[model samples]
Target: MSDKPNLEEVTSFDKSKLKKTETQEKNPLPSKETIEQEKQAGSS
Candidate 1:
């Protein structure tokens, strides 16, 4: 056997691949009446 140890190959990690794609669209908040209905529905 050779005196030198066998080495494993290492893969280069790309930072761009790790980054998450952000959604451009923003969801609007619920209306006042909708909020009241939600609360009433949950309580009943």
Candidate 2:
């Protein structure tokens, strides 16, 4: 039998920290132009 841990059995992982870190590494919010365009599209 292989010694590697079973990936399918792990269901308690908290990914919020990882996601937050990744978002922080990149821009947390969209740019002003993009936000404006989205708003305009939504209004239309």
Candidate 3:
């Protein structure tokens, strides 16, 4: 009984961690060049 709950918790945590990693990989943050271009456009 105790082992079952522990295993379920571990599996759920791992799935969440993997999902976060995949999301980050799919949608990366903007780069420095992109930021600079945005600033330049805004100033103009």
Candidate 4:
């Protein structure tokens, strides 16, 4: 395994320090519905 830090590891470390979830930046991904909608729109 690489020594490089993963986001989950870094974020978990912060949580151990009592960091608030709401205050932390979240990684958002497009939902399947939204992705399909965009694809359909583009293909039109």
Candidate 5:
């Protein structure tokens, strides 16, 4: 079968029932202090 739905399916979909989720940061970047410490340790 094709990946895309038929025109009838698209037209019959309930858009109002869809939900919205909050934006989240799963893997945040290291802070400036942490980065600087890593650099100093590597140079030593």
Candidate 6:
């Protein structure tokens, strides 16, 4: 219910103007194979 900016307005703004940065994820998510293995292990 707060006065947040509209999605339409936000999307219309130019993103190319923003600064770019080279960054890596500190904690990356598990791969699909790892996830499947974990799920199978849990279900067993």
lDDT of 1 at 14: 60
> In model 4, where is the ten-residue run with the lowest total lDDT?
14-23
Worst 10 residues of 2 by lDDT: 17-26
- Tens digits of per-residue lDDT, candidate 1, 1-44, equal 99976554324546676768887758888999999999999999
Give TM per candidate: 0.41, 0.38, 0.42, 0.42, 0.44, 0.42
lDDT of 4 by residue, 1-44 (tens): 88976688665564456755556547888899999999999999
Query: Candidate 3: deviation at residue 35, Å?
Result: 0.2
Q: Candidate 5's residue-wise lDDT over 1-44, tens digit each? A: 99976799788999889898899999999999999999999999
The lDDT per prediction is 0.78, 0.77, 0.73, 0.79, 0.94, 0.92
TM-score between candidate 6 and the true structure: 0.42
Measured with C-alpha atoms, the lDDT of residue 2 in candidate 4 is 89
Which parts of model 1 have CA positions greater than 4 angstroms off?
1-25
The residue-level lDDT of candidate 1 at 10 comes to 29
List residue ranges in candidate 6 displaced over 4 A: 1-24
Which 10 consecutive positions of candidate 6 have the poorest summed lDDT?
1-10
When superposed on Cα atoms, how far off is each prediction in RMSD? 9.0, 9.3, 7.6, 9.4, 3.5, 7.0
Best model number under lDDT: 5
Give the best candidate by TM-score.
5
Report the poorest 10 consecutive residues by lDDT, candidate 5: 4-13
The candidates, ranked best first by lDDT, are 5, 6, 4, 1, 2, 3
Query: Candidate 1 local accuracy as lDDT?
Result: 0.78
Give the clashing residue pairs of candidate 1, or none: none
